[model samples]
Target: MILVSGCTGSLGDTRTNDSTDDPTTGNPTTGNPTTVDPRACEDGTVRPGRAPLRRLTRFEYNNTVRDLFGDTTDPAFSLPSEDVGNGFGNDADTLSVSSLLAEQLSTVAEGVAQRATATPDALARLAPCASNVSPEGEEACARTIVERIAPLAYRRPLAAGEADELLALYSVGRTDASFDVGIATVIEALLQSPDFLYRVEWGTSDPEHPELRRPTGDEMATRLSYLFWGTTPDEELRMAAQAGELSTKEGVRAQAERMLEDPRARKTIRFFFDNLLPISNLADLERNAEAFPTFSRQIGALMREETQRFLEHEIFEGTGTWASVLTAPYSFMNGPLAAFYGVSGVTGDEFQQVQLDTTQRLGLLTQAGLMAGTTHSNNTNPVVRGSFVLQKLMCQKIPLPMGDILERVKPPDPYSGATARERYSQHSQDEVCRTCHQYLDPVGFTFENYDAVGLFRTTENDVTIDASGSLPGTPGTVSNATELVQKLAESEEVHDCFATRWAEYGYGLTLRGEDTCTKQAITTAFKASGYNVKQLLIELTQTDAFHYISVASQE
Candidate 1:
């Protein structure tokens, strides 16, 4: 149960061990560190704070097994869903293994190992030596396989003792079954090993600064593969690590650039957007059936696909900038989704690029999946929509209303007025409620032209929709969703927040004061690049936060 430094950080500036909240005060209390290293970040160098041990998410695990043993069965789905801490499922702090998860892991590992060693072709792909050798050579062949596969599985070279442990497991299997079964036994052990399950990095020492430690080349290779490919590193990347190419920032950037061009990088990019945006489970999204007769689960699924395709196209195929993501006057849609949106002539399941009518829609903000996912089943909620844009895009924290305040300030009924603006006007009218809603309602009101299901509307209850609202930092009010996204595309706050989110996703750290300098440098570079998403990803690899680590103890 050895924990890393900063493993239980408080919601404060100081590093402390007491992460529990005080019952009376409702504020976290800090405690002195159980152990401290005298050599700490001193000269204002960018502090690469320690991250907790990371277990692979279901997505990562499935991708890894696919690349590792050519098993595309997606065995990891049997495990529990990950806790989405700090806006991402991959956040390390909340990835601890539960007793249920531990039981599920054993079942999953057994199933994957059985499939991997089932056929002769699979056995040969894993270890040719297993079949080529005679009866006496079976044990030797097993050793050869373990030596070769264990490093790839652990993502680092195994110590002599670790190798012996795997060989011992092989012996137990050999005693019970055939050689292939023995190999299966070894595979089961490898899959369930802590070395295979958790990314445990006890970094190598730094001669230049004894206080700071850095990830070994192999560890860096693991980071690069998971961040870019969302899977295990290929042979070329492993060789680069073995050759000491990942020790320098330039070398890391070169590898990252090459990895980004691979097809697997497309999946990684889509995965990030899936977590960051509101389109994760659109197929199961609820909607008022009678209000929209044509809306089906299939259509909801198409809505999610449209958003994913739009993101992949903009970041990779289009201009590859934040501005393009927010203000592009085009989207990808299939015949079904097109028909759902009332656009004609699109005729199949495959998605194609379609020019949007710029007057009513622009970029991701106007995407149906996002709009529908954030609103209610029967009516649009301005408070929910506005809070998402503010907290996610603007990085503004909205404190919860105290006690019975939320009960007293319930959302206005949709039938209370002819238009959504009139119905939600109490948010601005009430002095107590206006204090918090003022920051949210303005930005949310601009999307009033879109109904609960995100279809464009000119009127509600025979009243013309008035979608005019102002943002806190923008120069003036916007006329509609299109104009609002345009203003957001030009916002420095939006750019900075986008950069911060990427850093958090890439490094798997909840950024703090220790990461301030590092975060600032990344945002500065992102702005300089005109908010190019690809360039920001490369810039993430070149920072101290990606290359170094702070160990909690000598272990």
Candidate 2:
């Protein structure tokens, strides 16, 4: 329910609950806060603002790929590695623009456009104009292309001359050897344009005052699509945009729900899972070969896939509560993973969750990905695992330790070694380190029974592992990975944190102090939908903040 910075926001002062700070209408003040409302503490909204204009995050590049193309290609491979501020990669303001990224984008765009033109699934949905194609026909061709892809590319249609200019580029491209090349060039240009890369907040024209501008319906649909589906608007959605059905809250809600029902809507949920469990590049993960002999590169990856299948089942196919995800008795596994997890009924490439015989295999906390990511090449870092829980799931930040983690990498004496907790406590003997590590290492020690590659282990350094730990911000102990997941599933903070993350995604940037109304609305959505990820998305995009932009930002 509370923000991680708690009171130490990177920006300015925060009023916990200011009546004037409507999350929907915004802070009634966009700039810095003046006098703090006395009512802020009781009902103060933690409205998060933009960190600063940074560069496009890796996830944004991936989402853009999935949206522009189908969910087939993965172009983030060639993109620049992200510079993370807080935890998220896509904090605009913190994001930056560079020649290197632009070059990469150019190449990616060419590849994506070529694939879009040729691929069956993608070409089937292409909106290219068969009516005209030439340097002479550039205007008509551009007009048709702009009309169809514009709503998606710019998140709104272009103005009268906008298509004309793009057509001019197409005319230039006509000098190229092929029509497909020209079209691909245009699509490539659109992807690189500031219009596509950034959240272009274009206001629509006022009917009463012809000179006034405000966002039109197509713009609203673009906002809804990116917010809910993490993609460009499909044809039906584009039709609604052209027809002016996305301007009102009711219309946005209807469209959002419809998108959720659409097969593509799952992209948003999948994105959330990907971010939460950064599995996009499993091919790169490494484990200590000798200690984790069973953890081949393939097994390292199988764990992530199992988690995905498990989540897909929980979110889309079966019960949709956070509880079911953690406490559910079932899990999916390919042959290797099933053998590792010691479960049956699961065969080859296909995965299906068969009930496990033991209660220890609760949820994500017990999962191998969570385990491996938290450990080092040959050892488990309880601090990393525990800190992840505190910072990510609980919305409580364990202050970053002052220096590099203790460089002591030697394997401990197993025959005489204490539990993982005892080994971890050695570094915290210093005063400065104890401050934060105390909070994290204790919680992380619970998964010590799982080794570097997440394979269950009876002993570490020849000593039996101890998988017992306690939660800092909660009641009861997480005796092991099983109870840890149960504790997280029941925690309101986890759900609230996830919902807030979704709100941030929906708005296409971080929700600012002015945006309490949206988070409040999101909270209502979580409660009403019984914490369904799909349902909360509809409620979020239905709000004015999802589409409405102030007049000046449009410029």
Query: Please, what are the lDDT tens digits per residue for candidate 1 over residues 269-352?
Result: 888888777787789877778898878888888998999899989998899999889999999999989999988879888999
Best by TM-score: 1
The Cα RMSD of model 1 versus the native structure comes to 6.3
> Model 1 clash pairs?
none
Error of 1 at 49 (Å): 2.7
Q: Note the Cα lDDT for every prediction shown.
A: 0.79, 0.62
Positional deviation of residue 41's Cα in model 1 after best superposition, in angstroms: 12
Q: By TM-score, how accurate is candidate 2?
A: 0.80
Where is the poorest 10-residue window by lDDT in model 2?
Answer: 6-15
Candidate 2 deviant stretches above 4 angstroms? 1-76, 85-88, 110-152, 175-185, 205-215, 403-416, 550-555
lDDT of 2: 0.62
Candidate 2's residue-wise lDDT over 286-370, tens digit each? 8666755666778767877777878888878878776677677777787888777666666777776677544566666677776
